[model samples]
Target: MKKEGCCLYYSRKSPMDDVPEEMTPIWSCTNEKCNGWMRDNFVLSVQPRCGQCDSLMEKSERLLPVLTNTSPNQKKN
Candidate 1:
């Protein structure tokens, strides 16, 4: 029997962790009216068109800026 504070665990697997080696993500499209964007499996030969506007698409890398917390005194008010 397992103790109140101690227990045994078993190894588990998920389908999401089984991404094929050749799987590659390619940008589908981005809505100009909104910030919505999407990607599809290129190597997997899945949906190759934009799900939003059915527009032709290409692979792209999205970049996000990093923000650092500043001290209260450092903030200009």
Candidate 2:
């Protein structure tokens, strides 16, 4: 299984791979007071809120194939 974490950083990878880079969700927030930002794929169930602005953060972009989970019984081929 694979996992991802919340960070203000990401990489630009080529789209040739089966796991296309487009599948990744990108989030950004301008609220300086609050670190009010998080990715949908983040494991934590609680959503982050803007600390400084006291406002709800917003999703910036929608990526395809939101990878929710993987199964151990799945076929390798």
Q: Highest lDDT, which number?
A: 2
Cα lDDT tens digits, model 2, 1-77, are 87987778565864545564454553445665555554455523244445456565666655554465454533322
TM-scores for all predictions: 0.30, 0.30
- Residue pairs in clash, model 1: none
Please identify model 2 stretches exceeding 4 Å from their true place. Answer: 1-20, 32-37, 50-55, 62-77
Predicted candidate 2, C-alpha RMSD = 15.7
List ranges where model 1 is wrong by over 4 Å: 1-25, 30-36, 40-47, 64-77
Query: lDDT per model, in order?
Result: 0.46, 0.52
Clashing pairs for predicted structure model 2, backbone only:
33-52, 34-51, 34-52
**Model 1 TM-score?**
0.30
- Locate the minimum summed-lDDT window of 10 residues in model 1: 38-47
Q: lDDT tens string, model 1, 1-77?
A: 87687678776764554543443344745556533344342223343456567665566655322233344443222
Model 1 residue 6 CA deviation (Å) reads: 35
